[model samples]
Target chain A: MPEERRLRIPGLKDRIPAACDFVMHAARSAGLDERAVHHCQLAVDEAVTNIIEHGYRGDGLNQSIEIICRAERDRFVIVVVDDGPPFDPLWQSDPDPLASMEDREPGGWGIYFIKKVMDEVVYTDEAGRNSLMMVKHVQDAPRLENLRDHVALKVSVSNPVDDIWLFAPHGRLDARLCPGLDRLMTDKLEAGKCLLVLDLGDVEYVSSMGLKTMVSLWQRARECQGNLVLAAVQTRVHEVLQIIGLDLVFQIFPTPNEAAAALDNPPA
Target chain B: MLDINVSAREQVTLIEVRGRVDSANADQLGEALTREIESGHTQIVLDLAGVEYMSSAGLREIVSALKRAKRGPEAGDVRIAQPSYRVREVLEMAGLDTVLQIFPTQMEAVGSY
Candidate 1:
């Protein structure tokens, strides 16, 4: 099924939220998951904010944004079209997080987060406007038995018992829910088990509160002589880690299973 | 667009901003502040209670005003009061909250100065 929606709101910052709300409702009605809907909203926010801030330059020329949603059997596709400059947001260099706050830069994180959240992100300049297409897979609904009964985070521990693996998260870790994950990790660390594998497969977005939770967990694990390892990180999160040079600080694996296996056998 | 209402009491200049602060009308805010500052009013309190949303570009205007005030001969300070949560988040994200003195109430903001 294909449905198209368009909004022309003068390219002003105030209208961004309304635009985001419209996209979210459309995406949800298209049968996307809540997490996926949030991702789409964030992507739209970042892209449209860029257009309003950088593209229109406050010209008040009634800058326009168009959202197109197409639902397939297993995936939903959402496209954002803006009559902005010929800039490809995907090509922008990820900011260096290691740089001091004074030297650190603003922006660039939004696009990066969009890439991380959506399953696929593509950018193109068509007919003098920028188009960003984001795809999200609609997984079969979780089985009743597998559904989380409570609000607790369901952490999958992959590593063996002897070696230690750590999960280190960086970026905007909001205070509301991250502490729950941190507490779960700390509980495992206190058990004196060394091998730990962190499943960062689902974490692409975070805030300052989330960052603190990660650091706190890392310190707790270190105190127990257990090592921290990160796996399945999105490019933007990885860039932040690398900029801070934390890529050197934490052992990384491409997947949680790989991290778990590495914990099982020490490289000698 | 931003609607501004100015109220002058003693030496304090209170500017109330209504509606959204985006790229569309951020310049108007800067102009208003510049006109006030040019009119020899140094102590300024901006009431953002009416502002529902603000973006980074809108935030730049406020920052610009702060910079202009700092550089002005009068050495005036621009303070924001009663900012909405969304506006407050943008300010915090941009790290402007630390650079500008923000108060929760207009009376407190004006009384402090």
Candidate 2:
């Protein structure tokens, strides 16, 4: 059975947070991971902010906006309705993401982000109400197929200790690089070196594919009576782990040395 | 909720922002950046290590600040450091990552200016 939730707020600027929180809570309850929840929250925030600012024309004290979230088996949907004049945010053209600083303009980014993060977006006007619908899958469908075939993940392995090995991977750990990391880690686990530390000091990003790779490595290591730990996680990657609830599942350390020490000590 | 802290260095001014940056308090961020720019502190390094989430409204403020900082004769720049994953994703989606110089560390961002 699909679950549905609804929230209505005055078109005031202060109420945007409430609307966003309601959507986030609903997204989480629908079994969407933290990254998906964040994306939903962003879409809602953008839609509501646009309603209050552009739709209401800065006078939203009396207007009201309605937000509805529906969780299906495979996807989650957010619908926002505003009792304002006819304004379709998607009508605006997308701004160039690669434009130079001098050529950059900020006005069109809100709509651009909405389109980028959400799997689908639709806008409608009926009975004097404007509605914007955004949808995101629970397990986001893969967009880049065979990406690993072209790009290579630069990984360096260091046997810092007799029993522990540290693997440092550079660049983004997305679909293109996760396969390589997975293969490398799998090889190490098969070789009886199960106690592993992933040094993410140079890793700039981690996609859903990367998280899946890490989980797989962790599970494989545990099956062999060994463990995998993360080390030197950058601030952004750390936050991603926390958002996806992996912070609790993974033993994260500040440095490779500390991670090696933990591997030796082992929480008993 | 949002918390912004500003400290002026000899060559660059560092602004540390924490918490959620949304429509409700985006004006505060805009004002802070404006304050620095008005005071002739064009060389700015924004540290987003603590930012939990940021909306398009917050990104707008950043772009506005970047434009204002680079407008006049002094021609200062705004660089970013240590943006959280969510914030970085949004910035990248908005194409601000291409327009602005982003460093991995605060020291690097400040040093770039």
Candidate 3:
């Protein structure tokens, strides 16, 4: 049987998160993987947040939003209803996700995310209510987005020790360069390197997408009983890791040599 | 909406950002910081503990602040402190942690300046 959940909340900003969390958990329990679950959550979040912000304009304290998450054998369906002004996300022009920071402006992304993440999205206004319907299939077709993207990072692979591969990625390691890093790590792991060290001394920045990539790499390494170590993390980068508490997740060293040395001794 | 409260502590302008700093309110936060920089309040300590959710747009705002803070040779920097997990995750994601000063406490961030 298809599992389903429904939630109705004041279309307030604070309530939006709870709605998203509820949907995300429902999606996860419905057998959606992490990536699919996140996509669904983002789609629902963006869609509802729009209604609360632009549609109502009054903080949505008096308005109500309805969210329904239903999971079929091979798909997840999300439906959001609002009593605010008639607004349709499908009509908004697409924003370039890869736009340079100089050209990128804040906002206008709610609809864009809804379009990218959801397999299908339809909007309708009937009888003083706005409805947004979104669908997510289990197996999405392969995306060619990365193929057209231009990565900004310069990755140089070095093997300083046997059985351990060191990846030194330079430049901005944001979402744009994550695919490259993911590909590199996959190749290295598939080649049977048991230990890995990422030297970030030359890296100037690591975006949230970059952090996700690192976490994914660390998780993959652990699955094989191998390890991924972070070395030469600069002050700013180190602080970010500490702030995020990822410093505890991975064995961190002040220098690459130290990381390599620790790998030899092994971590408890 | 992002609620930004600015208070001065010696040489640092302490800006506390509350609420989510996503695409919706990111521009307002960026413009607020730009006003501060234009007013010569370069030394800054940003408290992010109240931020519930943050996205790349928020990171871009910080990057802009960093650039504004480093405009001159004698310019002060924008220090970050007490970031919530969501804020810190995006910070780590952008690798901005390598470029920005992040302290564990607001006092530490201000004291560093």
Q: Share of real interface contacts recovered by each model?
A: 0.05, 0.72, 0.00
Candidate order by lDDT, decreasing, is: 2, 3, 1
| Candidates in order: C-alpha RMSD to true structure | 13.7, 19.6, 19.2
* Candidate 3 per-residue C-alpha lDDT over A135-212 given as tens digits, one digit per residue, 9 for 90 to 100: 776655234132123232345455666677777775567875577578668877888775899989878788889899
The prediction achieving the highest lDDT against the true structure is 2
lDDT of 2 by residue, A201-229 (tens): 87889999999999999999999999999
Which residue runs does candidate 1 get wrong by more than 4 Å?
A1-4, A7-65, A69-78, A83-85, A90-122, A125-129, A133-268
Cα lDDT for residue B44, candidate 1:
92
Q: List the residue pairs that clash in candidate 2.
A: none
The Cα local distance difference test for each model comes to 0.65, 0.81, 0.73
Q: Write the per-residue lDDT of candidate 1 for residues A49-92, one digit (tens) a residue.
A: 77766777766356677777677666566777788777666546
lDDT for A240 in candidate 3 is: 81
